[model samples]
Target: MNKPEAASIGLVKRARALAPLLAEEADEIERTRRLTPKVVSALIKNGLYKSLLPKNIGGFESPPMVFMEMLEEIAKADASTAWCVGQCSVVGMTAAYLDADVAHQVFGKPDDIAAWGAIAHAVQAVPGGYTITARWDFASGMRQANWLGAHVQVLEADGTTRMRPNGTPEIRTILFPASSATTHDMWNVIGLCGTGTDSYSVENLFIPDSHAALRDDFSALREKGPLYGITTYSMFGLGFGAVSLGVARATLDAAIDLARKKHSVGIAAMKDNSAVQGLIGRTEAKLRAARAYHFSTAANAWQEILNTGKLSEQGRAAIRLSATYTIHQSAEVVETAYHMAGATAVFKSNPFERRFRDMHTIAQQIQARDNHFEDVGKMILTNSVIPRGPTM
Candidate 1:
């Protein structure tokens, strides 16, 4: 409706302010796979989680690059915290695209409210609502969310999925309040302990029609405003990919610093070791290249959205594929940095060790690295293979 305060709040400046708080308790995050209450409170007070939503909701509605830049800063401080916040904030973006009434019902509670969940797991079709019996692992930020949005398929009375007029079944996302769902404590892992990305479920949860919405309807979004014209899920990919790139970039920076001070056993110091120098140099180069590819695609897409108002299905897929490639490439670079960190890092006291684990987890972020190669492979043959668009 009205211009938000996004222009006034410099995204980088706010990220710089939060880095110390995030770094101060990196160990705390490592221990819990979730951020400490203090860190969570600081994020809220700083308005860090609302960066993706429009300023009308007290958020920044910052440019896509802001997500990339800020995530790198946060990743530098604590990867797990960055991971959780990234996922949480993106969910808020997705919710903002729903019907205003639906948006309000879920994100309506308070100015600082956040919603969490994934669109990955598939739900079965049935009357009233889909019989959601899928295990959605890695539900980062689930611990702090007041609401969760899950993917579903419309079904007929006979338990068959209902097909649209185009002979395609409509896939929907259901927004369920946190109170109605049960959380599974399955997040114990080697990294990102503070993410609390445990399993959650809603057995036969009859989510009312209003809380659930489709992504394909354009007329509805036009009636609302320009904000809805932007694809919420694509924005999520931008934010999450930004998190991956940031962690990789931070890992490279940390390794280089460590190299400058320490020396190899035979050599004067790690900085003098040609081997270490090469490793760090290569890591830095790779991270930059990967980031350039990611941000450039995202920037162009956002600019296009501002100009043309919406993206073609192919355009959205291209951006998504770009993020997938970025995440995969960045993880490879971070792994190289981890190698430069050496055996001392395994002692657990080394900051580099925690980051190594964090970056590895970043690769496993469902939509990014781990799934990228396969998705892209599937996409190459999309015409004769995986059907494109929201249907697939």
Candidate 2:
């Protein structure tokens, strides 16, 4: 393999090596409602923030598969850490669409930048830029992120919606210094709490035109690598799916360990029980099948992009389908393990308990929502293209 390929492989190993340390700090991370400074430092030291950034900007720009692999390994230790990493990595891809100098200035120091936010509301176009007045929620990694992005519908100076040729309101994601926005301490959640996915608000924040970029705008992209060819939303689906798979894997292993030692009043060890044995087998099969399907679909799309310099609509649809299916199946595997653990799974001290919560939370994310299935189905059945939105 070439140098880039070898470097990618090494990065995967590096991510795996961090798992033990992450697992050790999982409780602290959840309690703090954010990654500790030490954990954040570790991620920066390993260059994870630059995983998807262009190599020209001192980033790895690794293939999507490599990115997924690294996420899976990190998630195995703590889903929140993996989720934070996934969010930062995906946002880092925006650099490819930015002006060369601007991209360098904003993303040059990967260790100093971590961007996260939601797409909601609109920004009114002003003379030189836009005036932003919105509150974006679920801004994962916000606490540690030095930068934040807000996806907004562009409104004309007269407050009319700016329209594109496709009849959709033109939208752009505006980046700002994190200090410009006030964060609300509202990340209390049942799972993935360590992600620090709180609500943030900006009032009349003026961002220059150069600070915003049209998300997924192919024509505006400066880096023409195949990695940039994969739409941003599609990349999120893939990476989040990998995180679900990792969580399921870790939970299953915990169940197996419990079964080996725990004995009931009327039964021998749980491992010897035929029903428990069957549950484990079925869960393993489901997890493996889902993982295989997701990775295979991702690999095919990557290869197609490499060959054609772009991903076909069908390929994008397949990615949506596979990621949705993988996430749902992963939830099922986690549920099965949690159930089989019986009373043991209820205690917070047990690994199965937290993972169970994390799995369900993963299922609730936009990428894992069942609505994606319907979107993909409509595309396949009606021969329509996948609609460009969060569902993609």
Candidate 3:
């Protein structure tokens, strides 16, 4: 194996080593509605924050699969931590598109970079840069992030929309200091609450040209690595899918432990119960199959980019398909395990309860929507071009 591959394996081992500590702090994280400073420090100290960054900038620049594996290990301990890590890592990858000096200024220090937010605002062109006035919601990890990014539609100096050749308004992601934006405490949800995915807004925030990156403009990319060829959307699908998988695995383990010890009024013991036995067997199969499919598709896509310097549409579609399927299947496994655990699963004191909630929330994410299956199917069936959207 190559040196990078070996290094990635070591990183994954390190992530696994942190699982016990992350699990120990999961309750406190949930109570705070954000990752505890200690948890964040552990991730930073372990070099997980730079999993997707370019090597030139003191990042590991590990392959997508290695990044996903590390995320899975973290998620197995705490889904919220995994979700936040995934956001930070993927956002860090954007550094490769930035100018060297700007990248250094924003991401030079591992603790200084944390870009997590959506972009649905308008940016007006100014002399040296753009003026942004808008609000972005679901800014995960915002509480700990020193920097944040928002996607915006570029407007002309006169306040008219700037159109590209395709007649679509030019869109770019603008980066700014997190302190410059006003954050709203609005992340109350059923699960993954520790992500602190609140809403934040900036009024007339001036972002210099150096702080903006053209949205998915591969031609403008400064890094020629294979990881950069994988679209951010695809990475989200894979990373989030891995998170779901980890949650499912944790849920299954919890249920099995419960089964071995508990005996309901009717059943002699959960272990000896025929129905429980069958459910366990089936759920394991489903989870393993989904995991294999996801990793295989991701690895194949990564290989294609490495060999050819570009990923084909079919490869992208396969990745979308596998990720979507894995997430949904993982949810099913968790649900089945929760059901088998009976009353124990419904209690907050049990591991099954939180994991059950987290698994469902993961499915609710845009990346896990079932529509991706239809989109991939249409592309494969009709052999026509599929318009890129959030899921793809």
Best by lDDT: 2
Q: Where in model 1 is the C-alpha error above 4 Å?
A: 1-9, 109-135, 216-219, 222-227, 369-392
Q: Write the per-residue lDDT of candidate 1 for residues 134-209, one digit (tens) a residue.
A: 5465678888887876765666666677676678776676777777788889988877788888878777677666
lDDT of 2: 0.88
For model 3, the stretches where C-alpha displacement exceeds 4 angstroms are: 384-392
Alpha carbon deviation, residue 183, candidate 2 (Å): 0.7
Candidate 2 per-residue lDDT over residues 1-392, each given as its tens digit: 77876786677898999988898899999999899888899898998878888889988888888999999999999999999999988998999988989888788985756566778999889989989888989888888888899788998878799988899988898999898989899988999989999999999999999988998888889998789999888899899999999999999999999999998887688888898898899889999999988888888888888998878888888898988899999999999999988999999898998899998999998888778788788776887764332322
For every model shown, the clashing-pair count is 10, 0, 1
Q: Report residue 305 deviation for candidate 2 (angstroms).
A: 0.9
**Cα lDDT, all candidates:** 0.69, 0.88, 0.86
Instruction: Please tell me which model should have the higher lDDT, number 1 or number 3.
Output: 3
Task: Identify the superior model by lDDT, candidate 2 or candidate 3.
Answer: 2
Pairs that collide, model 2: none
Model 1, CA-based lDDT: 0.69
